[model samples]
Target: MALAHILIVEDDAEISGPLERFLRINGLATTAIASAEDAASVLASDEIDLVLLDLMLPGEDGLALCRRLSAANGPRIIMLTALSEPTDRVVGLELGADDYICKPFDLRELLARIRAVLRRPLPAQGRPRQTEAAYRFSGFAFFPQRRFLRSPAGLRVPLTGAEADLLLAFCQHPREVLSRDTLISLTRGEGFAIAVRSVDILVSRLRRKLANDDLAAEIIRTVRSDGYVFQPRVLAE
Candidate 1:
């Protein structure tokens, strides 16, 4: 396997210096940038596989930068934030951050998250050579390659990274009751330490986006004791 190139977008030399050195020593290519603006330029000029973006920066805030980068096909982002609230983490995920590590995090945990994100299959935009596939269900079409959902009326429904991942898992295994743990593992990867409640939030968000009428009659059905299941017949091609 090729060495993964990582961009460290942290302003503090105290943090970036040792982090960059550690990553380099571990057989990864590293670039340390102090500001979001420089990070943008470096990302454009270099082939960076992942970004360790600090939420607090001198110029453009990390959240704004993450929003902009998420809108386009760019490097996978793992936000670095001091905020520990679940809402903050959800917001970051909703804005397209692939993962996040709180400030003063363990280097081992950070390295594990970096590896987990890297191990994930690259999005369609990142892997253009792969054949595109679409799944159709309940008047909605999901283009996994493009990471977008199309309504029955031919309108595009936007989806956050987490929502898209969860929806795809359901569509892939229609009618099967998937437990919270199962869903989390399928969408976020095995050994990912995310709260199961987050799955409930993603499910609610997806239902709001995909269901036109009563959510109870939506394509995704809550299976009381089992978990959740996709009620619609799904066809993939």
Candidate 2:
């Protein structure tokens, strides 16, 4: 496999230089930028796989940079901030950072986060692709390559970002009673610290989109305390 290219957007030379060397020695390519302006220049090149962005920069704040990066569809970002506040972390996640690490963090943990973000499967956004080890269940069809989910009557369902992730988890492990905590971990990214009630809200929204007015129990049956299950036979594609 090709080495993952990482970009470090940190103004502090003391921090940026060491992190760059650490990652470089670990079979990864690295680029270090001191400001958001320079980082934006790097992003326009479209070559980076992951970004390690600092929250406090000189000119534009890290939060603003993150928002611009999200808007421009730049590479995946993992925030590196000195702020230890939970609100700062939550805001970073909401702004689309894949993970957040406070300053004075271990290098190993940072590397692990980088690997985890790189390992996540890409979402389907175009024409469908086929996969043999695939399944059809709960009124949805799974094509791994395409990441496509077609309804039972052959209607194409357009899932939002969160909905696609939650549905992917359900289809992957059908019939298993996944608890609210488990579901949240599977669907919500690691940085998400939302209430468990959010899962119910997601389920309700997904159900309305999938069922229209038909509200059938067989489609994502909720177990009293065990959570929910994808109650359909999954055909391997």
Best by lDDT: 1
lDDT of 1: 0.84
lDDT of 1 by residue, 1-237 (tens): 148999999999999999998888777899999999998789878888889999999989999999988787467789999999999999898788888889998877888788877876556544456667789987889986556899988999977666777888988899899999999788777888988777887888888888775334777788887789889889998
TM-scores across all candidates? 0.90, 0.67
Per-residue accuracy of model 2 over 25-126 as CA lDDT, tens digit each: 888899999999998778777478788999999999899988877655456788999998876776776565767788999999888777766766654333
- The most accurate candidate by TM-score is 1
Where does the lowest 10-residue lDDT sum fall in candidate 2? 123-132
lDDT of 1 at 33: 93
Worst 10 residues of 1 by lDDT: 120-129
Model 2, residue 14: C-alpha shift (Å): 0.9
RMSD of 2: 5.2
TM accuracy, model 2? 0.67
Q: Score each candidate by Cα lDDT.
A: 0.84, 0.73
